[model samples]
Each structure stands twice: as structure tokens, then as C-alpha cells.
Target: MADQQDELRALLKDSGEPTLERAIAKAREMVDRLDNVTLNIAVTGETGAGKSKFVNAIRGLQDTDEGAAPTGVTETTMEPTMYLHPTMPNVNFWDLPGIGTPKFKAETYMKDVKYQNYDFFIIVSAGRFKENDMILAKEIKKKKKNFYFVRTKTDLDVTQEAKKGETEEQTLQKIRKDCVENVRTLGSPSVFLITSENLARFDFQELVNNLERDLPDNKKYALVMSLPVYSKESLEKKYNTFKKAAWAVAFASGGIAAAPVPGLSTACDVAMVVPFLIKCYYSFGLDDGSLEKLSKRVNKPILEEVKKSSLVSAIADKSSLATKIAAKLAVAGVVESVCSLMPGAGSIAAAGISFVTTRSVLLEGVKELHRVAEKVIEMAELK
Candidate 1:
């Protein structure tokens, strides 16, 4: 109980998970289930700016044509269209209709689109960032939130311009500068050039990296883990974060020690925790691009975490082996009452401590997950 109290205090310090005592008690009850997390992305731009296409690209969806909120010359999307995360169902991309078309008033337009629900905004444009974009950028900045400019259709535009006889170097340089210059109109704009057709081109990797880097450690870790592996660096970074997050989750779940039943701690994890992690990923903005990439790397179908009961089962089964032992050792108070308790072993308490405890067992699991992800990342190189 004392051990559980300590862990609860630690996990609840900044967790915002109600209260530590109640949380633990509740967690103990949820060993068989999981929770939820939600991430929201907003796409907005003038009509014909390819916001919908960009959304589809980031999501690894085929095309944003028909039944996809429309991506043509005319403003096919009259009102905000919300696309649920193809993989992580809880996460969503809000296509906040077109804003640069005629008669766009910032305040009313934002209201019409229900702007408050989004976690961040991506203002996309095909040609150049416009005055309407800058005005909204200013408003977003003033609101103390985040926004990114996605220069859509970079593949077509750059290819056409370069084919007109400009050297590849000159064409690339001109386009880069042009995008930068256009975004400069808005205060502190970081432009990401991308093509919905081929996310491998332009700055899709850069954009994803920046988004992860700009967040807090936990958030960055969550975001990175949820995203697909675009490069070796991305794979490695995500592995590092996943390892860290796994450790953190273990650290938080350590309080399972307080539960009276030997494996009852399992219930706390299955119910309150494992779900919390999946939810955390969603809330951290899990999407199809990330899941699809993860699937490709893992060589398995990637479903939204919400639909991943099999994953929960796997986690429970895998973790049960370790947690049952941890709880048993805790119940026995094997550490304090031992220096000579390990039959004939020296520093028996230390030896037992080395084997049990949240940090040690969890460290092994984290390493295993990392190893698997790294191997998968390596395999992708060949394919």
C-alpha cells in the first residue's frame, strides 16, 4: 500500500488524471480494458488550394477526389468537413472548408468551421501564401497556438517550371525561396512543401519531424511513436520515444503494487492503463500516415488503436509475465527483509531488487520493442 501511494503521487503530479488515490483504485479495477486519446488536425485554405489533397496525402489516402471533401478548382467544400483518422479513429482531420475564396471573414469563418476543436492548423495553398492566410496566421499566433503552411502540389508546379528549361538546381532554389518568401508575409511562418500524390517528395519528412520536435517531451515522444517511419532517423527516434513512453507507462503503473491480489495488478493495467496509452497516442494525433507507415515497417495491417483489441491482448499477455512477478516480490517485501534471503546468494536483497521492480522488467520490454522496430526499419530499406 505504501509503495502504491508513492507511485500514485508520482504519476499524478502533472497527469491531470483526477486524484492519485482514486486513480490507482480505478486503475486497479481496469486491468482488462483500455482508454482513449484524440488528436485533431485542421486544414484550411482558399478554394483550389489543395487543402483536402494535402490532408489525404498526410493520411496516406489515395486521392481527395469525390467523397473526400473535393479537391478541384471550385470550392467543393462549402462547410467544414471532418475526416476521422483512417487508422486512429479517435483522431480527426477537420477540413475547415476554403477560406481564401471571396467573402471570407476571419471571425465568422472560424466560427462557421468550429475552430475551437482543433489541436493545430495547417493552412495549405497551391500557388503562394495569400493575404487571407496571413490574417488568419496573425489570429492564430495571437491565440498562442500553432499553425503550419503546407505548400501543396509541389510536385506538379516544380516539375512544370523546371521542364521549361530552368536547371534543376535553379528551379529547386527558386521554388524554395518563393515558398519561404510567401510565408514570410505571415509572422514566423515555417512552410512545408508537399505533394498529395507522393508524400516522399519535398518536405513531408521535415514537416513531420518539426511537428514532433516542437512538442513537449511526452508529447514529442507520443507523436513520434504514432507517426510512420519515413527514414532511418525517424525510425530510430520513434523507437527511442516508444521505449521512453513504455518505461513511463510502467513507472506510472508501478503502483499496482498496492493491489491486494497477486495478479490483480493486471486488471488495473488492462482497464485503466493500456487503454490510456492507446488513447494517449490518439490524443497525440495518431493518423493513417503514421499507422500505414508503421504497418509497412511492421509488416502488419495497421488499424486505429481504438480498434486494436488484439494489441491490448498482446500487451496484457506479454506484461503479465513480468507484472505477476513484480507484484509477488512486492507482496513478499523481498528487498528490505533480505540481504541473506536468497538461499545462499550474496547481497541477496540487491540481487532480488535487480530482478524485480518496474524499472528493470520494463527496461527489458522497452529494449525488446526497440529491437523489433529497428529490425523492421532495417528491413524496409531492402523493400
Candidate 2:
């Protein structure tokens, strides 16, 4: 109780709310904004440019995975198709129609796709950039929006060039030089060389870094959380994002006592905490599906190794509902255990859980998940 009062006083002072109620209300509003931020990405390219495959890869899905954007030699996206991120629904990828087609002219492509709705655009091409791509890039620029050029199929290019006695580095440099020369008319914008087969290789992470620099804070958070943990760096990005948001989540969940959840014995809202932790579970690639995929990719028994963590095991066991119930119990147990260890925390009632206590649980949970994710990355040897 004393801890709660002191924390509330600090919040009120820092927030300049003049009252505890106002401070808590402002904190909830901040949390709400973080939870609801949306990002709509527009991907445009010529037909057979591998745009659909790139879309699926960015969303952490294989080409044949359920809900992946359709891909083929011919145009598969005739209209703007929105594919929601499997975990972060607010982050959407819009696969726009292929440019330079008779039906969809490059000049009119942005208008046809309602370009105003998207945050930015990515112009993808399997080979050299086309005139239509340049035209579309200019159009997007004229509209005061950002667009990036992506050259795909670098893996195939590398393999084919290897048969010609060219080194991998030579082939990559040649491709990059060709792409830059082709788009030199657009002031030589950086063209990301990528392969949907393996995002950890080549310049996918660099593309992400550029996006992180360009996007607004809310949208950046959504993008970071939505992307797959392909490497240790990507996992660390997720860990930092979650760590930064922990205070807001804790305040929102513990500021007021909500209705008791099924298994929670504490005042902290297990409902809020469960979803946040589960998001971390998926974002950090600790879920069963993610682990299974990694395990198969690395030809190792990673799932079993990761499931050794009780928190992970609890969140990943059985069906989704069962998992949620188990996660709630596990989180409640953590809260109880944490409270027992904190001096004077045992005297606090269900309605009086301090923000400090909730913050500790959330940070600790995120830290543990991060450690497990880092181990997975190390075991898989993902660069």
C-alpha cells in the first residue's frame, strides 16, 4: 500500500497531472495508443516480380503457409489485397496490383490502390528496375510518401552465377551495381537485395533498419513487434521494444483492480498481463510453431530445449484456450511469488497491488523470454 502511494505520487509529479486519478487515466490512454497503432504497408511491382513472396516472407510466413499472399509467374494480385500479420493484426501488408499492366498504368496505380491509406510503399523487382517502376516511384514521391526499391531472387542469381565461376560476393556486388544503375534516374535510391527463402542473409535486416529510421514511433513499434525473429539482432530488437513498453503495460494492468480472472489470486489484471506475455511469446519466436520451424530449419531438437522454461511451457501447452488458461495461472503464480519476496508486499490486498510489483513481473517475464529466444538463436546459429 505504501509503495503504491509513493509510486502514484511520483507518477502524478512526473506527469504533471495534479491528481492521482488524472495520472492513472493519462497512463491508460498512453497504453491504449500503443495497443491500437496501425501500419498499412503498400507493396507494388511489375508482374512476376516476386512481390507476393516478399510479402509473405516479411510477415514471417512461407509461400504456402495459410493466409500467405498468392504467388505465381503471372500476376496474382489484381487488386490491393491486405494480409494481416498473424500476431499483430493492426500491422497490415497490402499487396497492390502489378504495375505497368495494360489495365493498371504506373501513373494511375497509386490512385487506383488508394495510396493515401498506406504508410509507405515498397517497389519490388526480380531483375533490373523498369520504366514503370521509376514512374511509380516518382508518383509516390510527388505525393510526399516514402518508397523503397527491393531486388529479389538474389539466391537464384548467386547459384546461377556460381556455375559461371563467379564468387558470391562478386555476384551480389554485380547485382547491386546493376540495380543502382537502373534506378539511378531516381537519384540512386538504395535497393535492398533479398531472397524470400532466407531473410537472415543479404540486406533484409538493413531494410528493416531503414524502415525503423523512417517510420513514426507507433508504427515503428508495430513493425518491430510484427516481424519474425530471424537473428539475434532481430530478437534483441523485440526484447528492447517489449522492455520499453513494460512500464505502460504494468501501469494500465495494475492501476485499477479489474474483475478477477479465472485463476488469478492477485489484484493485477491477469487478462492484460496474459495477452502482453503471449504477444512476447509469439514475437520472440518462442511459440511452438515458431520453434518447430526453427528446429526443422537447423536440424536440431530446439522445441524441447525451449519448452524447458516453465513460463514458455505453460503458455505453449495444448490448444489456444488451454494455453491462455495455463498462462494466466502461471502469471498469477509469478505475481504471488514476487509479492512474497518483496518486503511488505504480503500485506497488500487484491485491490492494492502496487505498480512496482506488476512492473517487476512484466520485466522479469520479458527478460526470461528474451534469454530463451537468444538461446534459440544461438543454437540455430542464425547470423
Candidate 3:
């Protein structure tokens, strides 16, 4: 009996700490995984709830033409339409049409829209949450899905306007006044203000962050990246998004890690660079009204911004697009490569490369970005 007891003690000693520790670690991991899943948001309200516009706003679209839900006083959307995040499939923002269906009560409406699949519900109202809205919210809470209220369309005329002496901005203010007054009537704790067309430009980021904060780290980052550009803060977030995406594209391109075996990784890099350039161009309104704005910048003929004659540029020693792009790419790549390369003198080489390249690239990008920013600022100036 003594010998048997001693053997049992030795067995316990060998497995005790590590076994317990692993079990504890796994429990923590499971806790994290509980919130790692993709979240779907269902947006529903009465007819003409600006649901379409809200969808566009969430997606970071500037125009409402593609976003406006078929608006009418009656059943416009026949069924639940899924608008999955175009780039990120794990998250889809749903647009459910005409929530207060004539035959369907608020509770039943949730079932029609497949509410079970959604992580949250956003019951939008152009004015205020009606009886139907409250019922839907109450039922959703009972079933354990998070719900939110969006009061949309404060950018239009409120009370029957005659379009008299008041300006467009004045008309907008009046509408805002009416919309706010309406929301106070419902008196719900979970309420948010947004415009369907400019959701990303206003309260959308706040909404996203609120929803994502409690989420697991990976899911949170993914959700944040899909939001549209509205402010410098959002843009900064986008830059990080681009950095991650670029690295992802590189990783997906297979082993550039082992150097070239006579392949077109250079071309791949060039293609990857295109997204960054396009991002910059769109940011500065370069492809938008930026050139027209540039025309006004010099206080000269519109054609002057385009350099009507290359012969004139030739004498000035100014570079063309290809040269500039190549230079910028070189600066970015060489600087990045230094810190990434191998040890000892390699480290020293990387430091030197990083110092030189970063300085040059930063200066050039800043100079270009500043010039474009100035043109935009000037364009935005009041006439």
C-alpha cells in the first residue's frame, strides 16, 4: 500500500502544474472566441425610413442615388435584402424593407426578417420611433439581440415649407429642429443621430466603435477598416488599413521571402502600389473636382494647371508621373527593407537605408500632399 501510494504521488507531480495551467489558458481562449465571430446589423423602419441612404452611409458612399431605398408611403421593399460588406464578407449590414407590414405585427416582422441571424437591430425612423418601433425593440431585447435606434433625414425640409425667403441651409436647420423634437417623443435609451448619405461622415464611426469595442481584437480591427473616410481620424485609420492590406497582398503573392527566381514580383509590387496611389488621389479629390480647383489656385486660365505645353516643363527640369512614382516607390521600399533585413552590418545597412529613404520619401509625399491639400482648401473657401 505504501509503494502504491508513492507511485500515485509521482504520477501526480509529473502532470500537475502543466495540466492545470493549460486548462486555464484554454478557458481564457474560449472566453475570447465567444466574441470572435462576424456581426450582422439589420436596419429596418417604416416606409421611407431612409434605409437605403443609411446603407450607403455605412459603406462610405458619397452619393445617395445608389443608396436611397425605394421610397414610398407603402410596401416598397418586398423582402429582406442582404448588403454584405463588399470587401469584408464576415460582416454584412442588412436592409429590411417596410418593417410595419400591413399583415405583419412588429413581433412577427422580426421573424420575417430572420432576426435570429443578426447580431443587432437598428430600427430607423425618419421622425420618431412609433408604437411599432418600440414593440420591435422590446421583442428583440427579450430574444437577446442588441438593438439601436437611428433617426435619419434631418437634411431636408421639415414642416410643409413654401420655399419663401429662407436659404437652403435655413431649410436644413428647420428640418433638424423637427427631427430632434420627434425623437424626444419616443424616449428610448438607445438612440443615435445619422444621415443616410453621410453616415460615415458623421456619427457612423462612433456607432461602429461602440459596437466593436467589446469584440475580440481581430473582429474589431476588421470592422473598423470597412468604415468610410469622414475625418482625419478615419483617414489615419485607413492608412493603417492600407498598410495591413498591402502586407497581406504581399504575403498572398507567395514566397517573395526567398528573393527572386526570375519572377514578376516587381510588377506585383507596382500593382500593389496602385491601391495606395488611388487612395491618395481620391483623398485629395484629384480625380474629382480637384483639377478644376487647381485651375482656380493659380488665379489663371483653367488650362494652366495641366501644363499646356511639355516643352515649357522641359526647360524647368520638372519630372513626369513615372519618374515621380518610381522615386517615391524607391524611397518607400529601401527604407522599409533596411529595418527588415538580417543582422549585424545588415542592421547598420538597414539603419542607413531607412534614414535616407524615410527622409526623402516623407519630404516628397508631404510636399505633394500639402500642395494637393492647399488646392482643396482653397477650393473649399467661400466664394
TM-score of each: 0.63, 0.85, 0.54
lDDT of 1 by residue, 1-383 (tens): 34543543565564456654454344333322221445678888877788777776555454632235455657654767787655456557777766644455776666666667777788888877888888887777777768888888877777787779876567667878887777665634678878877665678788887887666454454355455345566656655665454434543453333333343222223222334444333322233344455565447654343233332224434465334433433343433332222232233222222222444334443443344444444544422
- lDDT order, best first, reads 2, 1, 3
Q: Per-residue lDDT for 56 in model 1?
A: 65
- Give the clashing pairs for model 2: none
| Greater-TM-score candidate between 1 and 2 | 2
lDDT per model, in order? 0.55, 0.78, 0.50
Ranking by TM-score: 2, 1, 3
The runs of at least 3 residues in candidate 1 whose Cα sits more than 4 Å from the true structure, single-residue gaps closed, are 1-37, 64-77, 100-104, 161-169, 216-219, 255-363, 366-383
Best by the lDDT measure: 2
Question: lDDT by residue for model 3 over 259-292, one digit each (tens)?
Answer: 2112112222333333344444444333423344
Clashes in predicted model 1: 18
- Clash counts per candidate, in order, are 18, 0, 1
Question: Model 1 residue 89 lDDT?
Answer: 60
Please say which candidate is ahead in TM-score: 2 or 3: 2
